[model samples]
Target: MPLPDLVRRWQPGWGRCRTLPAATEVPGGLRVVLGLPGRHAEIFALDDQAVPALAERVAEAAEPTWLTVPTTRPGEVHIALENADLEPFPDAERLMTIELDDHPAHPVPNAYWAKTSEFRGVHRIDLTGHDGTVAASGLAAIVGTDAVMHDIRTDPAHRRRGLASAVMSALAVTATQLGATTALLVATTEGEHLYTRLGWEPVATMLTATAPMSALVRT
Candidate 1:
């Protein structure tokens, strides 16, 4: 599928996974009202070509908003800041997808164990330390044939312990059992390397930026 199509597919699942309000379609893309501190809402470009107009629209809005484009386009990023106070965030996110497969059994280390849970269509997996602390955790939500992955994290102290892999394997098994054929997620720079090694392919570069309060003021 095309990059834009994958983004469209990923949005609803992401919203569900995060328990945010449903995203509404806008002239050039989709919009979600986040209502969080320093982040009021977010607009996602439907395609690379829609970014210039979308950025201009974000500049005219009156709230702390984020403008995002799926694929890297330097010219568009420049245009986004040309007439507004938009500050481009680092290019540290990659949208990735993987075909679900039979998750082979993987044993947890002697000092750790795993747990799985589900609630409201979201599946969660956690690798817990021997003392009952979470070492690594991740969430997945199945939307249609796609499962959206979110919040895959391993504690700093748990680094290099393969706990992340264990969590991912558990989530994959859960998603496959839930009838999902593919999985999607926005992976950080560090996560991209891990997911890549696990066979997830990059769909596009995820770019995002937010404007300062002064920039949102309209004359």
Candidate 2:
């Protein structure tokens, strides 16, 4: 699919995956009212050309907001955001996707137990340690034929144990069982290493900017 059309399909599922309000389409892209501390809302620009306008919009707002643009050249997007008085966050994330059929099986490590559950339309998996502590976890939400994955993470104390991979596998199984054929997620640079190993391909780099911390403090 074209990147633009892929983004259009991806955004709403992302919001649903996070249980956030539906995204609203505006002049440049889609906006979601996040309303969290240090984050009042966020706008996902359709492309680089939309970044400047979205940056300017956030710059004039009293509430802290984030602007995320998907592009290969984050340096240019960073410069445009700086020009608009927005602070660009370092280490751009990757927008990744995979055909569920291509995802390989990763069994839960012998030391951990995997549990999958669903609530409010979101499917969740938890990898609990042998001692019963939660070691890693992730969630997926099915939207039509696609499944959006969110917040797949392992505890700092549990690195290098294949727990993260187990969490991902469990979530994928749940999503596929629920009739989803594709999977998508925004992954950190560190995460890209793991997803790529699991057959997910990068579609674009995601550059994010927010109001400067100093400015947010006064709001």
Candidate 3:
């Protein structure tokens, strides 16, 4: 299926833009908007649309704090910042979703977490080895019926011993118990097959962009 059509299959609360047509705006805004479900914002050509008029509007908005255009033409005054925290887009990543009850119970392995913590809506589990050093970790947040996992990482030396799986399993167990029925995660190229093996199905191709770093300084 076409990328846009596949994107449409995302449930309204999940991937609303999965099936977005090439030219449709996401509801309201000056042809741009934020929080249209999933991560990132949706906007038109950054250079042509936001140079003077829309740039002023971006400065005025209280949240999201940047302008995002999925594509750019030549000579656009946008910066694709190369930094650790830069958003992912254009190249493509996997947006995977899975049903909670579709798999076996995801109980945390007894030796998995040397420490665990939760504050407000976020949950964290630290996977430690015998020496009590943190080997891997995972995080998840539950909002309504959705539990999305982020930043699940493991140290190189600890990679294939199922530590990553253990962290996710623990997170899944906790998230499900907290009334979450839907799970969402974005996987990198290296991790995509691993997630698929764990039963997550890729449903869309995502492109993420954000306001240039200069925008923040100018504010």
Clashing pairs in 3: 7-18, 7-19, 8-18, 8-19, 89-208
Residue 142 Cα positional deviation in candidate 1, in Å, after optimal superposition: 0.6
Q: Compute the lDDT for candidate 3.
A: 0.55
Query: Taking the tens digit of each residue's C-alpha lDDT, what string does model 2 give over 1-219?
Result: 766667777887778767899988878788899788878888888878887788888887788788888887777878988888888776788999999999888999888888878888888899898788899999888888898898898999999989888888888888888899999898998999999999999998888888887234311
Question: What does candidate 3's lDDT look like per residue over 1-219, in tens digits?
Answer: 332332333223232223222333432222333444232244433233333444444444455444433222312333332232333333445667788776444444566554678865578888887777888987777756777777788999788777777787778888889998877776776778778878887764333444344222210
C-alpha lDDT values of all predictions: 0.80, 0.84, 0.55
TM-score for all models, in order of appearance: 0.90, 0.92, 0.58
Which residue runs does candidate 2 get wrong by more than 4 Å?
213-219
Each model's backbone clash number: 0, 0, 5
Model 3: worst 10 consecutive residues (lDDT sum): 10-19
lDDT of 1 by residue, 1-219 (tens): 877799998998888878889998888789998887666788987876776677777778787778877885656655555445567775537889888873344567778888888888988898899778999999998999999999998999998988888888888888888899899998888899999888888878777766655333210
Stretches off by above 4 angstroms in model 3 are 1-91, 104-114, 210-219
